[model samples]
Target: MLDIDEFTPGTGSYEWHLSGDRLLWSKGLLAVYGLTQAPDRGEGFFTSVHPEDRARIRQEMAEVCAKADRFEHRFRIVRPDGRLRFVLDRGVVVRDATGAAVKLSGVETDVTDVVDASTFPAGQGAAPAARGDGRMEEADVIDALFNDAPVGIGIWDRDLRFVKINPLLAEMNGLAPEVHIGKTPKELLPEVVDIDGVTSLLQEILNSGVAKRDVEISGCTPARPSERRFWKEHFFPIRSAGRVSGLAAIVEDVTEARKAQETIDALLHELNHRSKNLVSLILAISRQTARSRPDDFLPVFQSRLESMSAAQDLLVRRSWQDIELEALVRSQLPHFAELIGARIILRGAPDVVIPASAAQSLALAFHELTTNAVKYGALSNEAGKLTIAWQVSADGTGLQIVWRERGGPAVLPPSRKGFGSTLTGAMLQSTLSGEIEADYSSEGLTWSVKFPLNP
Candidate 1:
């Protein structure tokens, strides 16, 4: 095998083990991030990446691991001094005997200077001045970055006329680079964008020689008039010979990111509403339990709480979406989990899913039925048989459930209604907006419920 220890100036190697979640970096690799040592175990090394690029990098790496062995990526990093640098990353995933990805090893190289030189190109008028060591002059460095930074870049003279703009900015503005020259923001941009605020800020920067970072602008672009776009901009004065001559800006499009954050906000709002509803439910259940069984409060209440918690766990596991009927039944009847289809019969449409709003009520009802069977019905003896089944109505919009017991001690009507019976009957009916019926006879107990399946 070829030696993989090769190292060069401005380049570093790294390896990570998926099993241990461990990352090891060569000294040169640590130096690339201005660190003298490896990060603390799993220390979020991605934090060094620019925030805007972090998610994309992680997603790309994941896709790479899933679909291919080799990968190449370029992204920006912020060093200890808070300066930005561009790096090229290339890596390979190591697979084990079972075709499982076991490790990842990679090399990274600082490519900022080379990319800058390429952006400046060979024939962009006069040659840029150079230092004694042949390094590029500061002016040329600025010119290069203004021409080809990843974000939109542009310069406007004191007269507020566009003097220069990079291709990315030109595309964002829905105009060609040459068309932007000698034009004011208002003249080139769509009226819908109404760039007066941006123009005023540019004027302020030009006059005061002050910089403004993270200034936000939102409107529709001519290229996409229907969808509103957002951008975060940085504006700073361009100075020559100790005098402010123009204003320059870099703009980053954040339209997708803005939409994503808005979605997260909406989800959080929904979660808060659901949490309040859950607390109210617990309070109501507590009050009813205390009134119904004051003497045996702890045991009764605790069992009921466990039943609700099992349903909640399923709901959470499914991200609050529909819960499968079979899964809910199994969870609510924990004592018979391993005995399904043997002594405890279960029949239902495997595809039927219970709406989240009705899941808890149904779960509680199942729990009560099972508990009662164990005490005075089929589950009380060896010869007992329990059949729990459900089916969708002919219209497919309603559900019917049955709990039947046989072959054990016969059950009789209680002297009076209890909390457990209420949970399986009236409470379930009211919660699901449906009908329930219970029959106690010499053979056994048969309880049935009908409800609309939609929430």
Candidate 2:
């Protein structure tokens, strides 16, 4: 029987035989120890094992050999150069004719590689064993979930090293995946290192072991200039054995939605400011117009101003965005109707809707026309009738309005142009971008205008 304990540079070997109840190491084992002769007869080669590993190695070897178990063990030895090297031995215990253990034989391989953990190839060091068949399959499922999620997902260790990061997570942070893998946020992005708020939030997530969702985080990416990105961040504890492991994060980008919300807020602020200013202007105009007019004309001026106010009301309802011509006409025509009784007929394309700018201009023009009819056109005579008709041209390029009167005593042109007439003509030409014509016929008067409907 032979027991080899350590590895030396030179190799030696010899056969050993047992005589009388005494067992001795072979000449090869003696030569391996750099001795020309065998050791003291009773001393075992286990003495050659380094002092730290001798007892445990001997105990483990005896247990395995006695139980007829597989021989597997590791120990260290001090070489001739005074360097310690680790060795692993594996072999079976040989049995005698009576099936009783008599000798042990094995092969020893240098395992210094395993003892120096860093020297092991990446991912080849000691890891948890698959105690159950389903463990690895479950791990595979977890890996798949991390890889396939549409939203960004990542796992960080307690030390802030990225244990796992999906491709989507890397893209969301505007970094290539390899750059983030196995790196800490402080290592990859130094700007975030001293950010106390960020550090606190991360620590809170790690310590609390509770999930937090939609917590907004800023300054994730500083390189992009187009706009700052907004993120709805979710943090949760990665638990193992009912203890908090680290943190897992899921991020959702919401930059566009945030911008839209900001724009809406700004518009509301502007609209409120504009509306207050407009009301102030209207009040001032109303007070001044009444104070400057005679009592008899005050009612007429107030009525006209009211019509103007109605048009502005419509515009304000639309957030000053737009207005419909038909809406403006419908809202104000009842007041004009009360003045003329059955003497006037109104007709036009009631379906036409115009912009807010044009609606205000056209509403003022209508007020002028009604005022003129009440004063001199046809409403001045009890027996007279006025007919107002309008239509759009074939190409929808323009609108033409005709105001005709009949049963008046005589038709004549006024020597001086009236304010109402002047207002209607100027507004039709300037505001609506069209022409006005007043035709004095033998039976009555006819007032007509053609305006472009470009709006």
Candidate 3:
């Protein structure tokens, strides 16, 4: 019997005396089988063999003993604790002078971790062993690696028929592994696969022996039949005896990544557009302010620019989607909090969403109104009061805002139009495509603004 202590952990040796059906198992083999004590005879080992593989292993052992030939087999064993483990058994038979088998000696190595790490599909046989050359063959390694890889992998013959497909690739196509075998891409995925083009590509790779990398393919797959998906695929020529035989492909899903890149591109374009618009707006404002108030242009221009900056800050916070009218008004009146609930009355539907362009225009218009009110209008006197109200049109297509002042000094129309009046009237109209009506009666000031909801 081979010395049990000489064998490494996870490995064991065994000797079966053929004539007497006697067996000697190393301590390692006992541990490998989850046994507390050695079995009585060589046949006891068969009892631990998985039922599905018992007959085949027994027959192979019998033949090896009778013929005194070398034996190599990979099979699963059932431990006493009901745990199944894969193992490789290899040995040679010893015979007497008459060539009748005397003993069978072999080494059994645990291969459970190797097989599990491979993640071969269920029912796929145990891992293959190295051949006599002591090096694992490329074909065997490729087979194992292909099936166990996380990414989708497949092989197509020169005829464009699926020669083999891994479980991952089969799942991506929403088919079973067996269903993909011997089927062309067009036949299996008529709606998704570009049959002619893919077939031509595979043929080209096989004939030219050239590899194609990072080719993006986009189409609706059965897994997500309604929405189109993107995949990054690389095709390599499978060679046999130094000649190209078929084409192999590895694929990765890139739908989310691609969509994310596209969204970033759109945001960059939008940013550039808004930047151009802002530059043009500043140029116009500079020209208007210079012509209107050349003597005191700096102060007026700085105030207006500050108001625009505030409006832009609000827009940035909301991703420039839309601003609520109430929020816009509150943000623009931060310094007039005391008048908001006391001298000033605000009334409106709370759900109004102001368009981006209209928001900026309204912000500037509100700044002018509030400035005037603080200086000489409703908020200037102890008894002065102001009411602002807004409502959507009955058809829901337009919004109307009204501002009325009371209990203030008698109002009179300005002798000449100034920046405030010009901005509130013409600038607001052009910016928001709205109509404004203002009355400066002796009693007070009244203003009305009407605009399309979309604008």
Candidate 4:
């Protein structure tokens, strides 16, 4: 066993022996002070300490010696090399037989690795944490969580001033985090009305002594060039000294979710309405098919009907939110591949995400295009190639997609519209609410669709 007076280095630790106004610092202490010598006054350990902390360290030393009482304090020391070092000073006070203060000893550990001084336990007389690391230590874990977290975080003070902000919340204001700190919601975040309103809500918590949790709030960020979307905000109160002090809010940018939900609800409503309306269309189609080919009850038509239902099933699976573009393309192209005796080449970014409603519409439109191509266009021949490529814009505003066909039958515009034409047109118009063009040339057919990105 080691004697209490004999300080041993464990992990990052140091021992300091205080006797009168002089200190005998261990090798570990010297290393932390960035000193060249152990217990050598000539090493200038005192000068290495940050000037502001020197007096407090001295005063605490005097009190420990005067009362012969155990004491602890934290202070910053400037390394002889000029780097600031944060250290915790803790030790016992020893006395003589007459009870006169003789020695004060303790250990100083460097805790600079941890981020966020507020998160660390600051002992009495512990120096206000060094200015270096702003984040609470263990930033890697936080970084991973920040990327995966569905909600946003914002740290604020009692005065409603922002202290720290997570990337998600920072992304909300279209501003970087550094620009937001020390700014009140109304001052820097005028774009965030919901956050500005949180000021009063936090005030209520402060005045009433009650913490607010999971309170639902909604508002829009400042208008961007395209569209303004809304978000649902959740405010959580941060407390200090057993009193409501500031706020730690988590914001969920639910604009897409809300829009998707609305689209689903609307689609469900339209599905019901169209289920009734389509009966007439189905009856007409059945009558027309029966009249045109009375003896031939073409069961192949049932397969087509099944295909439509399967498409609806896929849409329902995503709740009309979005679908995997590659999966959608691959799932719809196999039949056309066999018919045309060629392959549909899909070349683009892998796993590029798209909205649900857009997926449903794009899937249907592609299906119709492929069916028509197999029957009349490029896919009709084994020598043909159907290539599709997509790329997202730098601004993230929209995606650019190009579909080109080569070495196929000469293309010509349809003389009259058909089910495939009407279906493709309607689906693109509804889902993208943007742009579509099918250019027919002697070479082949080129189909393109531009879908709006924002909800």
TM-score on alpha carbons, each prediction: 0.63, 0.44, 0.69, 0.37
Tell me the lDDT of model 2 at 212: 87
Predicted candidate 4 versus true structure: per-residue lDDT over 174-205, tens digit per residue: 76654554456776645444665667887776
Would you give me the overall lDDT of model 2?
A: 0.61
* Candidate ranking (TM-score, best to worst): 3, 1, 2, 4
| Model 3 global lDDT (CA atoms, 0 to 1) | 0.78
Candidate 1 vs 4: which has more TM-score: 1
Clashes of each: 0, 1, 0, 13
Query: Where's the lowest-lDDT run of ten residues in candidate 3?
Result: 116-125
In model 2, how large is the Cα lDDT of residue 413? 72
lDDT of 2 by residue, 300-405 (tens): 6677677778888888788776565556655666655554336666677667656555766577667766666667666677787877777878998877878788
| C-alpha RMSD for every candidate | 19.5, 19.1, 15.4, 17.0
The TM-score of predicted model 4 comes to 0.37
- Specify the poorest-scoring 10-residue window by lDDT in model 2: 9-18
Worst 10 residues of 4 by lDDT: 2-11
Can you give the lDDT of residue 165 in candidate 4?
Answer: 69
Model 3 regions lying over 4 Å from their true place: 1-126, 129-148
Per-residue lDDT of model 1, residues 259-352, tens digit only: 9999899989989998898888778778888998899888878898999999999999999999899999999888777778888998888998
